[model samples]
Every structure is written in C-alpha cells, then in structure tokens.
Target: MYTKLKDELLVEAYEHAVRSQLDGEFLQILKEELDRRGIIFDEAKKVATADNNKS
Candidate 1:
C-alpha cells in the first residue's frame, strides 16, 4: 500500500506525521517504509526522534 503511493504523497504523509508528532508505532512504520524505499528524511527523523524523547 505504501509502495503504491506517489513519491510526493509518501513524503507529504511522512512530513505530516512528524509535524503532528504521531505515536512511535505510526511514525516507525512510516519511517521504516520510507527507509526501505531509500527515501532520506534526515532532518525530519531528527525532529521526530527528539519529539518522541519528550514524551
């Protein structure tokens, strides 16, 4: 399902999840899928990780 999504939508979804501070599981799944597809969101990952640590 994730793979079927357009590249722009995938990145948009990831960015939204990070901005929304989604739960670890949700973010993890997205992150993993993105990584598997070789999509690098280094800054977003850093921000998401930092936010997760706050919870």
Candidate 2:
C-alpha cells in the first residue's frame, strides 16, 4: 500500500541520518570539543535534551 511504502521510506531516511552522524570525523570533532570544554558526552547529551525541552 501507499501508506506502507511511505512509512518504509521514512524509516530508511531516519536510519540514514543516524548513520551519517556516526562518521569518524564527526565523532572526532565531537570528542575534541567535549574534551576542550571539560564535558563528557553524557553531559553534552543532557544539554541537548534541555535545549530540545525548551523548544
């Protein structure tokens, strides 16, 4: 059905976006920035969560 196909495409796009963020360069930048700021990944995630919550 059309609805099923749409759902499948949406899921594929979402997975692709997630995988794209897992690239080595991106991870290296994220780690370096977090280290420079003296914040762990979990703390950075919490800050992101807070920002999203405000929205």
Candidate topping lDDT: 1
Q: Which residue pairs collide in model 2, if any? A: none
The TM-score, computed over Cα atoms with residue i paired to residue i, of candidate 1 is 0.62
TM-score of each: 0.62, 0.35
Put down candidate 2 lDDT per residue, 1-55, tens digits, no spaces: 3543333343344346557876766566555544444432243333332334457
Off by over 4 Å in 2: 1-21, 41-55
After superposing candidate 1 on the true structure, give the runs of residues whose Cα lies further than 4 Å from its correct spot: 1-3, 41-55
Cα-lDDT of candidate 2: 0.45
Error of 2 at 45 (Å): 7.8
In terms of TM-score, the best-performing candidate is 1
Clashing pairs in 1: none
Each prediction's whole-model lDDT (CA)? 0.70, 0.45
